[model samples]
Target: MPKVVLVGERELRDLVPLDRAALDAVRGAFLALASGRVIMPPILSMAMPEVHGEVDVKTAFVPGLDGFAVKISPGFFDNPARGLPSVNGLMVVLSATTGLVEAVFLDNGWLTDVRTAAAGAVAADALARPDARIATVFGAGTQARLQMQALALVRDLDEIRVWARDSVKAAACAADIEAATGVRTRAVGEPRAAVSGADIVVTTTPSSAPILFAGWLAPGQHVTAMGSDADTKCELDPAILARADRLVVDSLAQSRRLGELRAGVAAGAIAADAAVDELGSVLAGTAPGRPGPDAVTVCDLTGTGAQDTAIAALARARADAAGAGLATDL
Candidate 1:
């Protein structure tokens, strides 16, 4: 008899906290992708330009894992106008031994959020300066808050700066961050001002135009750009890649095809095959991270299927240990 477990959003959230366990799982996933024979296919993206939305399907299999995750993620930018959440999704966990459905997680993109935040931690751990004291987040949104927490795990962040187009939102984000992290936070007025003099910067906006520039970056700065996951999206100026002493991407192929690297290369700002480092390689110690305290580093993360599969497996384990999900036959 085949069996399947249905894990709902609340249960997954309760089971998985945005803490060290999640970060370790994501970090391990990166290392596996670097060393293991993990098979990950290209992301299948379907765009709805008229509706201003897109859906992407991602899946991957790690050789030794007992199961894998296939996920469907959708984003509708205009949903807020209709009083709806912009992002929603689900994941399917399948057993590797029998190729049977093991569990279905109605996470609504929560797992994606956690994994992506964890990737930021991995990047900061690899590239950010050891004495890093402050971080600047380029958008006041869900990711903006998460990035602050994730970065703190790796760096000694003492303060945070929040920037958004709307001043009210920016202030609110800063206040919330201060309350949650017990770290001093400020609402900066300008994008360039937010970038200046900060040890670390994280761009989390879903912008079609550039909001960060090379000129704003000082020596010894590290920037993590996680927003540009689609061809039409860009957050950093193309020239920023040229200013970096080290450029690491979550995946070379994905970044070249869809992320900020596409914008940089298409504009002739960076080489098409520039000795781009992969985050996984850096994590696995096959490649070097930031060379010194004065080196400028950039990490572009275009969320990977390996992350989804890893997080799904983690969620399944947690739910099973807690006896939380509803189980049924397939």
Candidate 2:
């Protein structure tokens, strides 16, 4: 029998914050993905359309890590109406040497939120102009607020504008970001008004249709699309990919099947065999990012199993150091 540790969300939040350490962990994951022979498979997704819900199973085995993580994430969109969160899940860490369960993170999706936002920050840091200031985010959900906080970690943001279908929620989200980051933040009624003139634009919605159009983009602007992780969801117009000077994705294979690139290819806005750069390759300097200040760049993030493994490993190590969680032998 192996000893297994169980850590809850409240403790995990204190252990892994959305700070430089968390950012570095995710960044290192991308670097390892690019430079090492990591074993990460395609996402296993099950759609429960009858209940407006979906579950995704993701995992990865990095070469140097002592353990790997298998995460099960479920999103029930209608849960909010029932006084429940829309997203919740846990991660199971297994020993690399013995393949036995070492720990279970009952983070309830907090880890995913942190890592996803960190990935967005990494993309903006790598692709956005060094002097990028203003930012616009579409969607007022958890990711919208976290993305702004994460961007504040890497970029010297001056202003953040939020736009959502529900204007009231957008205003609340804007107020929260301003208070949290001390950056001037506001809510706008028009999506175009939110996108125009922003140096970095991030779409964090679970919108099924296009909320960001191609014509709204400007040169020298960078876009991070993190919402289109499912085949049915799309935030950016397919034409936006066609118009980007440099396009990047977390995983080319996943993007082709589940990210915005799928819509682009289906709409013929981008080539089926387009030369797209992976975020890891860009971070590793194997591929180019933002060729010049005037270039328009876009990064499509469909989320990845490597991130779960990375964050989980970090949480487990930190918990051990802090003497957190409950250990039991079975």
Predicted model with the maximum TM-score: 2
Model 2 Cα shift for residue 55 (angstroms): 1.1
* Runs with alpha carbons beyond 4 Å of true place in candidate 2: none
Identify the candidate with maximal lDDT. 2
Looking at model 2, residue 163 earns an lDDT score of 96
Q: Which digits, one per residue and each the tens of the lDDT, describe model 1 over residues 1-330?
A: 677899889988899878888988898888888985888999999889999998999999987778999999999989999998899899999898888888999998999999999999889988899899989998899889888887777777788999999999999999988877778999999888888889999999989899999888899999999999988889989999998899999988999998999999999999898889889899988999999999999999999999999888889889989988888874
lDDT of each: 0.90, 0.94
Q: TM-score, each model?
A: 0.97, 0.98
Error of 2 at 40 (Å): 1.0
